[model samples]
Target: MTTRWALLSVWDKTGLVEFARGLVELGWKLLSTGGTARVLEEAGLPVTHVQEVTGFPEILDGRVKTLHPRIHAGILARRTPEHLKQLEELGIGTIDLVAVNLYPFRETVARPGVTTEEAIDTIDIGGPAMVRAAAKNHEYVTVIVNPSRYSQVLAQLRERGEVDLFTRRMLAAEAFAHTAAYDAAIALYWQREIYGREHLPSFFFLVGEKIQDLRYGENPHQRAAFYRLPGMGSGTLAGSLKLQGKELSYNNLMDLDAAWNLVREFHDPAVAIIKHTNPCGVALGETPAIAYCKALQADPVSAFGGIVGCNRPVDKEMAQEMVKIFLEAVIAPFFTPEALEVLKAKPQVRLVAAGEGQGEGLSWQVRPVSGGFLVQEPDVYDFAEQELKVVTQRKPTEEELKDLLFAWKVVKHVKSNAIVVAKDGVTLGVGAGQMNRVGAARIALEQAKEKARGAILASDAFFPFADTVEEAAKAGITAIIQPGGSIRDEESIACANKYGLAMVFTGVRHFRH
Candidate 1:
């Protein structure tokens, strides 16, 4: 009987020994290099070193070990008579199975204070070459890259006495994806090192691992899936842990992200209720319970079945108040034991624990266009105290300034043509995604009703006309905050002065389109 050879080279040694032992018991010879060879031998299994087959010592600090012609010729050879004759002439034996995984490049670069030299050293050259060679000749060779596939491959071999062509093709496809993702990570790391993070690369590469497939997208007919981008730190909606409720839908994720992002803007205990990617209510308080109560009062009708986000842990009192209304989901840094018990009655509500509540600064935001994508830096800019200009004759009082700032933060998270009416650290009403600035202002002012008399209004961008200012005045708004870059800034300022309203221009715009 001919000897069947299985070459194994891996960085992650998970399931390596057990799989190799199973192959040995099935009368196959083990071929490995360096650490993999040592592991197999220590497990009381016979192994053949790659250097022994090539009759050449590994040089260049083991960097040139598996790059030899002897290694590639063995894995790439077909089972044809012509290929077999050439292998015999070169004194090379055909390798039936190849198991190889690349070095931990992603993990190495993700470490804090990781130097460029360390990242370069972690890149695997010969590993990718051998994996690709084996995968290309998968009609005759079986290539495995993922350690989790070891058991499945072993089961097939044990049952059929050989791996099927169908299974081999699937493994080959996975092997190529594994190499592609590894290369993409390396490319991005170098791109950041060569040109700073602020610069955009000529070529863009987006890589993510699928976390789950949703039942549907925005609508029932559309398909959707969730993927977690690698190297993005924890405390993100994608990294959140679900403690209860059904699987998250596409809209659930969108609303949860909006709520979480808005709540993170405040240092005090904050709560935000979001529906359809718009905040229906937002407020800050000394405790989460107080914040939840105030936030719910903004627009109780709109808050129904909305997603809730809290910067602090959900205590017993907060949970009790939350259960009174039907909420789609509630995400917080933590949930007290008493709170968890109180929320148990509403098992349908999603309970997500977002660790630490510290949001990472994202560098870029990518959106799909017709053919390709549009990439831009995230809207992370905030106005400094010096950037604020009192355009109106009457400056905002200390109390009005505080509410203006609060409303400004909330407006930044709202969609374009957004307007927010807030007072006493609580949002009275929010109008988002309107076509015209005045239309958005009317929606917010109408919702605020009598409450608008003492509240301040915030606009995401400069009003193109004085109509929005006039609308705010008609609603009895006391103060207004806007980016103030329009050509008609004088008209809006004059209008505010006429209405006895204080208006401030922030010099920065936060347009969420």
Candidate 2:
């Protein structure tokens, strides 16, 4: 009998028949259950029905298919003397390779109005057991979980007609990750279904499959990889289908995400120019043409090499104007024929279209630490006018209030302890990623240059000290909008009064940290 017993089961039946044929050619008996067996039998491949070996039919609507001892013993049995003797005595065949992938619970649950019964039906109990069995027996059995690993496994099998210890170890690691991510999706959905929310995992872990290895990380020396949860929504990458350009770097993804978010905030024809993950300029106009011009005029120097996003389609005139300046990325819902042609001429421009993206509304964000990831809800909300309190005696002018609201929206997405100064639908200046609020205020004032005078200021958080207010006063800032939560709110209010700056407390705070 062949020692290589290949157990195959998969929801995504990509390359399964071919892989099974290859295994059979190499003298490995294909052992499978359910749809896997049917697929192979239909394809006329030699497959041993798992029930013939286990002596039991699938029960509980296929939930108890591969959870038997006959299957696991073959996978989990040690290669040591006593284990080998016991396996031989029990007629337990040594299962060598397991090709398994779980059901698509994420998709089932994500569907509109999907009942809990339907979602539960899609969760496979047997799949996780098989995967974990193979992973636990990495010392003796080879496991293949992701189809992405098919080529490498095929290469190893073709080159030597067998999987090596090193390859088996890596495959086992991937198998665990596959099942973990599968379980996580189920856990999140289950909690959301029953408890109305998925609480933080006490001992949380996620296994993201590598989508693409980027050219470099934040810098050229460091390496980076784009990872994705199998069934979860793909972020900017899913929506952004790159037309033509060099591959995106780590920093490029950052800037593009920021650009996409800010531009999406407005429904009107709008343009948002982002540099280093912060909006340098944003404007809403009658058309994409007008929006681009207004955004460009906001701060032309800073807009250089920035990522530009628009809510409306890009037209030929807008594209022609765009060619006049250098940019890293241009993203829009659509682009007119002439506009695409114009941008096509500029091959270096990374153009992306969002019209064919995954869904109507999607929110996903990822953060990386030295060792792992930190993923959570995106900072998304609307600030109602009723939430505002007039901290200063004087009420803001209608125009000033509109500009204040604009500046306030821009300030939230900026880095922590950040401050933004804007007026009349234009960004006067932005100070982001600063340690202290006062320092950020000072930087914005300096960057604004002559434009600082009379521009409204918006802070992501309340001013801890009165110095920032004092600085804005010296810069001739006319109005301020911020969330008032500082312990020294009275002192800050006094300083705003002293400087004659029309300040308001927008009870809703937006800290990007």
Candidate 3:
């Protein structure tokens, strides 16, 4: 009877000895290359080196180790009569199982002072080739790229003498996914090096590792999971440490990300209170405690059961104020010891810490549609004062400009059609995701009520008509700021002038969906 064969060549040598021993116990022959062969031999297991099988010594400082036809033909051969006759003629044994994990090219490049040569040296060429070959011939072979599957594969092999077709298909899918991600990392490095920073690649290769399987998606009945790109730095929720509280649900993470991104926009101490992935209130203050208070006071009714994010560390004062309401979570750079103790008072509230490291340079945002997907760079533009074009006859006062800039930042975070009313760097009311601009304006002004008299309005997009301006003027809006690009810009400007309201055209629209 012909002996079954398994080949192993891995950069990560996790569970290699025990897994090989299991295969040996099942009356299988083990063939390994380089360090894997040495480790198996050291573990007192009989191992055949690949050079012995291929009759070729490793050359070119180990770069030309496993690219020989002997290695690939063994993994790729179909178990047909003609193929078996040829394999017997050449004395080549069919490799029934292949366990391989590629080199750490992604990690090597992510290092702080890594050179281009070092990164190129770490890219594993032969490993991916073997994996793809085995995966393509999965009907007759089994492939293992992840170490976590070793025990399961070993159990199935021991029970049935061969891997089942269902498991082999699943393993093939995983192997393909692994190779795709590896290629994407390599492509990203070369593209960034060749194209430089300013240009975006026309083709996008996106791959992510599953970080979590959530309880549900947006709702309890829907299934959901979360995946994070490798080396997505500490600034994002993937790297955030959950210091305390219950497991984060899908909605909690979404709202946390929204609040965290909004708070990071301000240089000073800032607070962003969010609900359902929209900023209900946002404010900047001298301290986090003051910021939280003002943000919550913006719309106390909407602040209930919301997520809070701070640009600065959360102190005892901020924690005390936060626990007073039923908040879902709080995220910040850090939290004081006293603040942590106070926050623990509410066992259900999630506390997360965003560490110092942030993702490098420009990043892409992806969304799934019905047929395919959409990918674009994140909207990180920060418009300066010089970029503003005052369309109204009356230019905004310096104090009003300060407040308008503050409201502009807050309005960008709100869903469109969005309108934000603010005064003194504190958001009074935010109307988000409305059907019409007039409806958004009415909601914001109505929420602000008496406070809207002195506050300035910030619209997310150009006003298509003068109806929104007329409504804002009736609510005592003193000034207006919007991306004034509509064809009817003159109509809105004329209305603003008629109402004696100072309006500034940013010439940049922020239409968040």
Write down the worst ten-residue block by lDDT for model 2.
356-365
Is candidate 1 or 2 superior in TM-score? Answer: 1
- Where model 3 places Cα greater than 4 Å from the true spot, the runs are 21-28, 41-46, 79-82, 112-116, 157-162, 197-202, 360-362, 498-500
Which lDDT tens digits does candidate 3 get at residues 333-406? 88999999998899899999987666443377778999988877788888779999999999999989999999
In angstroms, give how far residue 97 of model 2 lies from its true place.
Answer: 2.2
- Superposed by TM-score, candidate 3 places the C-alpha of residue 96 at a distance from the truth, in angstroms, of 2.6
Q: If the candidates were sorted by their TM-score against the true structure, best first, what order would they fall in?
A: 1, 3, 2
| Model 2 CA deviation exceeding 4 Å by range | 1-3, 79-81, 151-155, 230-239, 334-337, 354-378, 433-439, 445-454, 464-476, 486-501
Q: Which candidate leads the pack in lDDT?
A: 1
Taken over the whole model, the C-alpha lDDT of each candidate is 0.93, 0.82, 0.92
Clashes of 2: 0
What would the per-residue lDDT of candidate 2 be over residues 17-129, giving only the tens digit for each residue? 88888788777888998898999999999889899999999887787878888998888888888988898999888888889998888778878899988998998788888
Instruction: Give each model's clash number.
Output: 0, 0, 0
Evaluate model 2: give its TM-score. Answer: 0.88
